[model samples]
Target: MIELRNVSKRFADLVVLDGVDFSVRKGETVALLGPSGVGKSVLLKHINGLIHPDKGEVWVDGQNLTRLKRKELARLRSRIGYVFQYGALFDSMTVEDNIKLGITDEASAADETYSRKRALQCLELVNLDPVVAEKYPAELSGGMKKRVGIARAIAGQPTYLLWDEPTSGLDPVNADIIDSLVEKLDDELGVTSVVVTHDVRGAFRVADRIAMLMDGRIRAMGSPAELRASTDAAVQEFLERDLTIPVHH
Candidate 1:
């Protein structure tokens, strides 16, 4: 499980999170939702030690992340897969290379054959043809790129997965496909997932639990049903419906 206690982060005069306390149990999918600049992304960085809080600590499965040294932190990160907003695939590498990226340090070991098989299996899980493995990132469509990224993330069978905007620019059908893929990864692979996204504001198709961040704090957090019932002005405003509202207005 992942746990945070009394965590607070600040950048000079600006505080992104304040006295935040939360825990994500094993195999749970938690969606981090908030308006732009609320630090939902910052929190995800904290989970992986990418950014550390000025105060408080982060623990994953009993390992104290904030206190870990540089090399230790790198090792820890290898066990957790992070999918950036744009898939962040290496432009020069083929789909196969991307998937095998996670197995880098160990690729020279005796287990290389098994690792290759595992990487290919991950591609199959994402419903991509194994032949695409030989193609470069530029050769695949956006969805294919994202799937390849996912394949790489799970190449080492990470225990935790962090997805940053998994469905930002995709169409509804593709977005839904990504959502199901996330659910499937967690359920079938038994990995803990934390998704940071702003898309939920428009679709309401978020994760099992949603935490709304505002003013450097988690203003409200609970199941979708619970957030829907919230009367808090900020929470209500975010989930507001204005289909008739003009974009220019």
Candidate 2:
């Protein structure tokens, strides 16, 4: 459902992505793995047209993101939900209102009754209580805020979900919680998902396939078991570093 062909992006002298080619199939969850300062997040933005690449093309659900008109891009984005790195909740709005903003369907967003019900349902789907919807972001714990962010992302009933560092900044316990939630949601919602994260354990636990980005290119990619059995130096180095296994080479 998503494809990136020869995509390249650079900021002045710093090249983030170089001839990157990536794809995620329908109903499959793919994790983009890379170290800090790589272009994992930048690549995610390209799928939804949030950031345009300097070269190459990005296709999502059959539409070329680079060629889409502004209105058309917006329409396409409505079917895809994005969960930002740090929740990015509006502090001024209640949790329910924050999630309500995710409702892109004009009629549903306009219907106060439907929005309220949808927000509550989304919160439940994220394992949050309905009472939390009445609270503000400031009132939530870090993990709770992340769950709320997820609730907001799914509030629109999107066909695709893009998560940018969903487990970042959380404690190990919270990170595991988020990982399990990602797995559960993928099974329940059956939405095509692309998760951008540096956490190898979480990626292994949640993704159907993992793609490692290094030196502005996809260095290695495969299922968790396949990656573990890989002999590539760069791939082995990364796996050993994150998994704490000894690297012979």
- Against the reference, the lDDT scores of all candidates come to 0.81, 0.93
Candidate 2 global TM-score: 0.96
In model 2, what is the error at residue 206, expressed in angstroms?
0.8
lDDT of 2: 0.93
Candidate 2 per-residue C-alpha lDDT over 1-249 given as tens digits, one digit per residue, 9 for 90 to 100: 999999999999999999999999999999999898898999999999989999999999999999999899999999999999999999999999999999999999999999999999999998899999999999999899999999999988899999999999999998988988999998999999999999888888888899999999998888888888988988888777778743221
Candidate 2 scores a C-alpha RMSD against the true structure in Å of 2.7
Q: Considering every candidate listed, which one attains the maximal TM-score?
A: 2
Q: Which ten residues in a row have the lowest lDDT in candidate 1?
A: 240-249
lDDT (Cα, tens digit) per residue for candidate 1, span 4-51? 888899999998899888778888788888877888888889999989
Clash number for each model: 0, 0
Best-fitting candidate, measured by lDDT?
2
**Model 2 shows how many backbone clashes?**
0
